[model samples]
Target: MNTNQKTIICFCEDITKEEILKAIEQGYTTANEIKRHLRAGMGECQGRGCMPQIMKLISQKTGKPREEILPPTDRAPIKPVPLGVMGKISKGNQKGV
Candidate 1:
């Protein structure tokens, strides 16, 4: 635990604790707003990697409770499927479904 090292909140996005706090200082008080500003929870893991910590930071900075923190809605597909695999799902091409 090197005290001088920046704490990484979002491993997928490489978002640092200081960066999130800076967003807070700039007046982005809510977790989702901060996520939007910093692109923190928009990475590959879709916020599972960072939203909780972001919520914690937001709660600490703004006196908001964790229960009240709501992460942004995930727009990406929950699981990725190969294009060819998806093509197999058609009525005539049900071979690989």
Candidate 2:
């Protein structure tokens, strides 16, 4: 855990600043690349929270415009879903399919 890294940024995966920076240094500049390299954005929340900050860091370090960077993958269940909610949703929709 690097002291300079925000402990909460990658809370779901516990990825550290050192790891993310190492990925950036290794040419994984995009958010998706970083996610793939470190599994930073591959957790339950699907990175809806940490992605913006990650992108900002990557842009600042690589001197790339934030807009030029491709957005992170929008995996299903953008928000955290409780198990009960998931079960209810599944049951509710099963009749249609």
Best by TM-score: 1
TM-score of each: 0.76, 0.72
Per-residue accuracy of model 1 over 3-93 as CA lDDT, tens digit each = 8898999988899999998999899988778878888977778888788888888888888787887767766465565778655666565
- Candidate 2 per-residue lDDT, tens place, 1-97, comes to 6576465567789887777877899999999989988889788768877888899889988999988877777866668789898889898869763
Off by over 4 Å in 2: 1-8, 80-97
Q: Rate the local accuracy (lDDT) of all candidates.
A: 0.82, 0.82
Looking at model 1, report the run of 10 residues with the lowest lDDT sum.
88-97
